[model samples]
Target: MQSTSNYLWLLKDILGQGATASVYKARRKQTGDHNAVKVFNHVSYLRPYEVQMREFDMLRKLNHKNIVKLLAVEEVGSTKQKVLVMEYCAGGSLLNVLEESENAFGLSESEFLIVLQSVVGGMNQLRENGVVHRDIKPGNIMRVVGEDGQSVYKLTDFGAARELEDDEQFMSLYGTEEYLHPDMYERAVLRKPQNKKYGVTVDLWSIGVTFYQTATGSLPFIPYGGPRKNKEMMHKITTEKPEGTIAGVQHRDCGPVEWSKELPITCRLSEGLKFLLVPILANILEADQAKCWGFDQFFAETNDILHRSVIHIFSLQQATVHKVYVHSYNTINVLMDAIFRQTGVPAVEQEFMYEGYYLELDLAQQVHLVPKTTEERPIILVSKEQKAPIGITYKEPDVPTFPPMFDLISDANLAKIVTCAVHQLLRITKSIMKCQDFILRGVYWMLAILKEECRKTLQRAATLNLKLDFCKSTMMRIQKIYGPHSRMNQSDGGDVHMKLQLTVHFLATISQNVQNSQKQLDQIAAQWSNTNDIHHKDSTIGKVEVLLEKVSAIHQQLKKDRMRMKLQYNDEQIHKFEKLNMGIHAKKVLALVREDCEQKYKKLLTCVKDWMRIACDIRKQLRSFGEQCESLHCDLENCEAYLNNMFHQIPLKLEGDQSTTKSTASTVYPDQKCMEMAIRMKQLKQEMEHVTKELQQNNMIIQSLSDGQKPQGV
Candidate 1:
């Protein structure tokens, strides 16, 4: 092939091929610079000479960055065949980019904005030049990567293009079937042979189809097979407006329309962008040319979207969602500052995460350019500091004083006095010991049960965390092996990975809390055991026992003194001696024992109050752990189901793509680790229920003691 500049062009590779011509990746011999060359076949030469020169004339008249530049027009050296040389677009057509697995659903919001801007700019250039690109589709749009790594789409393949004002009409049938207008489809595809004259509004219909497909990865209108096989049905669905029929879709030939004004659920664009885009789609997708939007309105609406502030939703540790408005030019630092202001977390302590990766504060990183999807979880802002634990306080009950000791000397009958005093002392000592023993044993049992539950709960949480880690590693490996274009590298995969990470982190936190509770239980158990030993040796109950023995000995001595006075002395002498020795000694000893018992009983009350406080703490800890376990259980279930669905979808997605590797089969089934986690979750739930019942019983025991009622054993 030869160019008009006398430069020899070597066709190194075929870039693309169409019905009339084939494009090649050609290199100039002198400069060795790559360029795209279009070589038309003999079929194209059969057209009228003026029709053959139309594309060249259109390209020479248009000069815009969004339109592909025409380099040189040449001829084949042997066959005198005409050839067109155009500037090379390294990024290729937009269709090839959309064919990747990651974009099977749609382009991300940021990426969609780029396409919108580029296409609108190109169309505006066409309007200014009075040119109509009769064949406007994804295949005709070329992508060029700029120096800053940004994509710019340009219009190419202008073979069917011509100069026509908006009001002018041309009776030409050209364009792909799916993107064609209903009137054009009737004539060109259905072979109905209608003489309908097409105007500039036909391009608007094509733009609407292309835009919808770019945003949602599927065509808007539909029939049973496709536009080719179901020609009449496709034309009717696009043009007819029954009483209850929607515009874009129908279930069957006479079935009700199933279209909605909102975008499909599979679209990844945000609700904010959807709000702006739907109105535009509704106006331009109209089959009636009179109702469709003109180029002026289209440019105005698209430009408005480009200049508006970006909206982002952030969640603070999965607790609260905050809506923030950011300009397109703002940096990540500014976004972090905004989060700090809204969440009250210090900027230095805040860690922002989008998808599964932490966001860095790079100067060149725009806040609005983060790769996020509507179906994915919100951006998470986590605090570096630990939250304070929830706590409950209890008021200590007032101590009780020992009852007044009986005055034996005041009683006229000596035998009765001894019996009453000895009986009262024995009863008091037995009651005190029994109450102490009951409280000690009850508290010890509760502590032991709580400790055991903590241990079991921690073990289950550890197991679940391990399973989560395994699943996450497997997902990461799949992404690595598939490269960036695979379905595993999309935003959905990031969402799954982020959810798994969150579950694992939560399990680790709960495990740490359970361990802390166990330590507290151990401390309470050790303290109760020490108190039990003291009860047997030097506690208030032991002191009461010693006092009972002393009282008995005093009573016996009094009886002996009474017998001696009756046998060996006169009445007056006996009365005087009894008053001086027996009465004084009995009163002094009884007063001392009563004082000692009162002090010991007060110490015992303090100890029991301490135990009550410790028990309340344990109950609070148990309740907290149970709640954490419930949350972890829910997270694990969601993560498991999401992973299972992802695994099932892998094989189906791979079947459509011939370029995928065979290793993807390894991850196409549900993992055993998720099932193991499910089993552990069930066991953990049962343990939680058992612990709850034990806690209720413990509360009852504590409440009874607080009311000063005797325990069952006592």
Candidate 2:
């Protein structure tokens, strides 16, 4: 071949030949590397231009090791021949591999699986790109000798490939007659347009036939005829069962026999291996296209066969492996089935124990949890009544309930709320841990008591706090609690009472959730504080503030875009105006489309802005809440110190003064320094009460903001 652009080629002998193209081994003069060049005969093809274009389009988009790589596409000037330079496979085709290995032991199970996986991988890539590989067979599959001296199979021949369109039909009768699916074979015989219709399933049928050939070292269906015997081959493919023989040193069908027994390869395999492979192979050979296995199912079943893991079953009394080397894919239910076989235990009566915890029977099918690696924990089994070796209890969290307004808010807002809650909990726990246990408990109890009082205060304040600035007409009309009727009557009844009850109910639930959160935080803080391992303090509040700023900026831009794209007229107005147009229907369709686009655009923008606003408000409230916690921490430390000093000042009980202790207690009760400390503690408690009120006010504000209320001066 002559040089084209930068590439110069020295063509060797022909590698393979097809109806439209011929593959030849070529050496690049520039790189001194060998590659395969598929030169197409433009004049010979029925639609040569179309064939060249589709191949180029599909090849350019694909990049995978298993799929043949298209190095370059060049045109031979003067002559209308176009060549596609691809990665050369010195190992030749799989057909040659099977022929070479026929006398020397046929392909091993592992080798067969490797080739199948590579083919499946390449086919999946084509499927993802919306291109169907219409032809899949042994001759089309080429093998490259890798650096590791092992053969790597690649899929070639894109001339028959076609892009899938919506609800499209395959009308062309393409590919080899022997490997063609029965449906396609029938279509080819009839040569009728209506009879030709298929999907990607035809390729799978070809793979099934290819697998039988590669596995048994011979084609499943054979035709006995002279040259030009495609009709005979098609007849065998359409009528005969896809059968293979595995007699020693002989790779052809000996007689009519079951595939499992007749195939000598399966005779050497274990019962379990035969059991799995039989069903998979059967599904692949299904005559009904709808019933045939797709890529996902095939890959999954094949994966199970390739990647095997062992599980060890034992009793609770001792570490003795009863059943070893069980399949990892075998579910707990399967283990129960095994129990019936080994020990006559019913599946319902059987319960599995792993790592001192009883596994939920509902999650029995998830056998992948069993350790596959050497470093992973071993699988343990025990009876339902059996106790753990050591005393261990699992602490599962209670199922959470969403706030009433949860459904009304966007997911982004919900996320921000949870994030803020976590930050506040962390802040409080870290600060409180620095003080005495009594001080921490005292602070906790103080908050608990204050929360109850705050609820009452909020209920009273709800009636007077009717400063509605955000959507007043909508809120007043829907709720009607803070309307003129209630204000004039001075009676909290009907909707007013119901709304107040809901507010208090929500407040109480919030208080309980807060307490539960604080308890969890306390446990975590205590565990880490005892070990002195909490070196890094979280700056969550700072991070959230920065995030809020970025969100707000993005929200503003989306809002502007939404406003600009808004439709100029309403649907009714547009419909009326279109009556004057020459093509009224066309104009009406355009207007309707425009209206739909505008509505969607506005909704998307509104959603974004609402989330940003929620995030900003939550971050701001959490910051203030953190600062209050820090202040409370300081007051707690001071109060604890003062109380400690007061106790220290009191006289210690003497061993010899049991009778005199009563006298000392009475006399030292009103000591001047102790009185001063008591007065200071009283003042600190009063400060705590003020802090409580401020925190409650903040909570109310957060609730109002979440309810779409505008901020105002308290």
Candidate 3:
């Protein structure tokens, strides 16, 4: 795809070719430095150019050592070609390295770990930037040889990469069949709608399969198959057991099928390494996305298994045992110094022992790791004169040094608090539902009491309508039930007239007190309801209810006007005018008392209605406060400051009043003082109203008696 040019780069021999492009070893014309150029033919190679440009854009944004660097993109007009210049990797691809080794089985365990760590580091970086490399296989990982003849692996090939938005799902199926996650296979081949959407978890599955193949020199699941065999392979990938070979089987739909025999990877690994890889593989290969290992979780598990390991060091001269925790990646000199501090010996004088032989100090100092036996056992340390022991046994002791306070502090951020608050709110909401149920029961109790009062009032009114003889008989029957202690007795200066006057005055006083207290409760309930409505303006339920209430009010006003007009034009009218007469008979006084009792019961009903409404309003206020607090807690930086300021502003204590038995069951006010003062003020006002109403009723009764007629019916 290149023409003769003397500009920046001079193209040389072709290195590799793909379906869309070819990579060539090129040298810089000015500096004579080597680099690789991926040339794309503008005619057919760059077909549907959007996808190609997306890959280029992703390459330009990536800037990590483990990720390949893109130097420049050049467009040659004469040749109709586009070329991308990238960092030169002299050691070729990791797949080539694996293939070059005999049967891909010569890679040492240490080298495999190095490769895995580098790839994982790169993948983690990509994830942090919201880029998912959907295609992650061995061929995409390239090895770059440094000036010192050591090689470092870097991830390449971003053709299948995608940038994801927050919480977004990637639905396209485009990865290698051999390395495809089982879910991806289900979407691409089986065309399953349920498996249509997946995310970055698929990348981990590819890496797991690639790791399995690299370690055992065989694919975990075979890639070759006909239609019937393909179905069998798909089923095997989806539901196969972990510790078994994936081989072709003779299906009923297909004739006898045969495949090559391959040893399971676990069989080839040492027991210790197998223990480490087994769990990692299980997590990575999990079919459920919810259970799959995240990048941080997977790395933490890997470090605990492979890097952070404990060893028992037996001291022969001092006759003491010390436990040493070692990181496998740390240099042996570091391990030796750790052992020296634990045993009170100098590093230079310490000699280490393995299974059957002593380690040379010169070799130990230069090595990067504390040597382990093939079985991965702990190493032993002894003085120069002491002989090595045959058996070693020691218990793990507690660490002598505690961590610094700053290090002990956990780094839980706002996001974690948000998650915890969600669960806490769920529990609180359930408790609130139970409280509401109890309140409903209370409402029903009040209704039952009111119903019984209404039934008694109706019976009393019916008895009043009966003949005068029946009324006398009923009064005698009531006296018979209560004997001489009945209040109806005219003896002992408690006649029916006096008792009736006292009863009307008492009923009036109670009604006034109830009405005043009900007004206070209504005021408080309205204030809280208004605040809740303002706070929840964005809520759909609140808005819809408000609209419905306005509509109902207008409809009621129209209905009232129409009924008023109809009554104005009626042919007949009913009217009753009561004139107070001072002359009161004993029978009429009893009737007055009965009517007063009914009015008192009606006032009690109004008090109960007001209390129920206030209770509901307070509940709504508490629910609103909880929702707001939950939102504030998510903003961790300002949550504590805001709450502290609110606390300082609210009045906390009442003046010169201390009573521990104050009712706190109604509302959750900012402080006890606010509730206490409000209740005390309402109680004082109610007492004054009660006294005033009693005096007024007594004056009206006296005036009616002064006029020489009975008082008006209550």
Best by lDDT: 1
TM-score of each: 0.46, 0.42, 0.42
TM-score of 3: 0.42
| Cα misplacement distance, residue 447 of candidate 2 (Å) | 74
In terms of TM-score, how similar is model 1 to the real structure?
Answer: 0.46
Q: Per lDDT, what order, best first?
A: 1, 3, 2
Residue 493, candidate 1: C-alpha displacement in angstroms: 73
Give candidate 3 misplaced runs (Cα > 4 Å): 1-12, 42-49, 77-80, 189-195, 223-232, 239-270, 303-714
Candidate 2 achieves a global lDDT of 0.51
How does residue 128 of candidate 1 score in lDDT?
Answer: 95
Q: Kindly list the per-residue Cα lDDT of model 2 for residues 245-308, writing each as its tens digit.
A: 2111212334332333244432222233444556666677666677777767887887776575
Residue runs of model 1 more than 4 Å from their true location after superposition: 1-12, 241-257, 315-714
Question: Which should have the higher lDDT, number 1 or number 3?
Answer: 1
For model 3, the local distance difference test gives 0.52
Best of the two (1, 3) by TM-score? 1
Tell me the whole-model lDDT of each prediction, alpha carbons only.
0.66, 0.51, 0.52
